[model samples]
Target: MVHLRNRKNNYSGILIAISLVIMITVVSLVFKQIFLNRNNENEQNSVLYIQLLNKAMPVINGINYNDEVDTEENISIKGQLLKLIGIDIRNPFSVIGKEISMFTIGTEDSSENNKVVKRTLFKINPFDVNDKQINKSGQDTGDTENLELPNRNVKVNDPKLKEKLDNSKPQVLIYHTHTTESYSPYANYNTSHKKNVCSVGDSLAYNLETEYGISTIHDTTLHNAIFINSYHRSRVTVNKYLKKYKDFKLIIDIHRDGMPSGNVSALKERTTMKMNGENVAKMMFVLPKKNPHLSKNLAVSKKLEKISNKLFPGFCRGIDLHFNFGSVYFNQDLSNNALLIEVGSQYNSVKEADNTGKYLARIIAEYLHSKK
Candidate 1:
């Protein structure tokens, strides 16, 4: 009987110890949370907190904090609650791809300005490894001589194209398929509107109208918010313009390239051409290899290349052929005159890109006018 009683007492002591430990852990977590909340609330006005807040919620961070929404307050409270339960919600980008639970949580943005983040999308992959390099000059080539090419316009005049060119309405439509493709020098410019590839388009349009009397239309529509479906979205815009305008003779899509070296770089890897002691971004003309009108498109790119190299040596990077028609049709099937031009890599400054635009306008004018 005595041994049984001793054993029971020992069991009771163990149960009590366990209960005390559980109580202490719960109490400690509660106290720590309270402390964290107080500190975060007090230090919310601090620069570090503001910066962290900005980085954490980029889309909605600029809005003024409100007690009704309790955005700032809730982040601290919820974060602590999650931490207490052993969930670290601090680095959301780190956990985004790793944790499946994250998908269940819908991020909310309550801003009066309608500044909402609909979906987290990846930026389009702008680097093309399969691009065929031909007649390469610029900094990489050991030969430091100015580039030169003979006038190679084997001009085959289409009576229909000549007829359309004479129309008073805009004959050339200059739009950006990847409208947000931006320069490294002006990285902070707005992506949703002008100051990116749209700016380059504007410059091209201005030069075309001013120098050559060519009536050109510059469409500044953005189509790459969801990078995966950028081409499809751009087709809608293209179709709209084609149906709306009867005088459209040339359809040009402008974009910039992203290199293996970071978008903005100080290295020689940045694709650039030296023009009159100033560095200018180089250009590439892409042709759809499988297009039914491949011969017609190739003729135009060849003409542009001929004039570009002859006028501004090293400015025109060789023509590239897009093999997979389904992956990137470039809306070439819509019109034989459609040309996709990559202006420069992201590393190039805005000034360099602008210089390319001026030269490009001149080349385009020469090509169009040559048809006469």
Candidate 2:
């Protein structure tokens, strides 16, 4: 009986020892997992992860990940998929990925020229449709015509302008820096009639040729298609015209302005005028500085302003002389007689843009006739 009791005790001791070993092994595994997880998190926040993120973020933003599936990049991306989002490989979507994409692109950093792209976070002039400060025509009461000369001795009057103006050849050149800029309330801004600025340019060209007997060259190059370095790309087209049409007296870059919609402020965002009992969009001239012909450009702007105001009061927003902001020369340096005209804002219908273009043709023709 004594031997039997000892045997039972030995078995119980062995069982206890086995249980202890099992507990130690389980605890060790738990600690090991915790340490690995912490190390993995640290790895995700490292410089390597950021480099990976920049490369991988584009994929999340719907950019195709077609960089050779068998490459090291693909393997790395797959391995670190958890860092991007820790989920089962079977899951197909993530809300955080889109948020990351928006944040990434929203950064005001331009790749071209290494310039810091700054956007006006808040509206410089708050616009409201019902503000008394804004005239019925949507002209800002404070916004006045600025025809002042910028301390330059040169004048805009050209004696040989009349002799140079010819109808048989291309005398006037009109192009859009932002060719794709279109108006609203029109279905598919690209296709909608009177909403497309290209059509407005066409109307202006037609009016000039038919009504005023002026020869105009309208170049419909889509500049904004390749959004990066668009101005540089547009330069190619502008230079081409300038070289081919050596007799171009006036090179006009037409664009429409943009403003916030729906009761944002006391500023009338959409510019308008009463033309033949119909409401049409008004016009504004932008004169860029840092040109040899600054005075000449200013003169042209003033002439257009005078004609527009005379033909349709409050139709002209006067001349917006760009002194410091923007590229000093908006291809204006390329030609002595260059004008950047903003017909109207995006809120205006294409019809309004077309109407402005028609009136603008007359104004330009009158200015050329004066030179002649």
TM-score against native, each model: 0.54, 0.54
* lDDT of model 2, residue 222: 79
- Per residue, candidate 2 scores C-alpha lDDT tens digits across 1-372 of 999999999999999999999879654543343344442232222323344456657654533222111121223434444433443243233333233433211112233342223332212222324345555775433331221212212121223332333556887888877666676554222533245678789988887877667788888877755233445666788889767766377898887765532332222333655556555666777765556778887887887788766665667876766343234366677777888888776566677678766677777777878875
What is candidate 2's TM-score against the reference? Answer: 0.54
- Over 212-307, each residue of candidate 1 has an lDDT whose tens digit, in order, gives 667888888877653334667788898998888843668998987655321123332335766655566788887657778788888888988998
Identify the runs in model 1 with alpha carbons over 4 angstroms from their true place: 1-167, 186-194, 262-270, 326-328
Could you tell me the lDDT of residue 196 within candidate 2? Answer: 65
Indicate the TM-score of model 1. Answer: 0.54
lDDT of 1: 0.62
- Poorest 10 consecutive residues by lDDT, candidate 2: 64-73
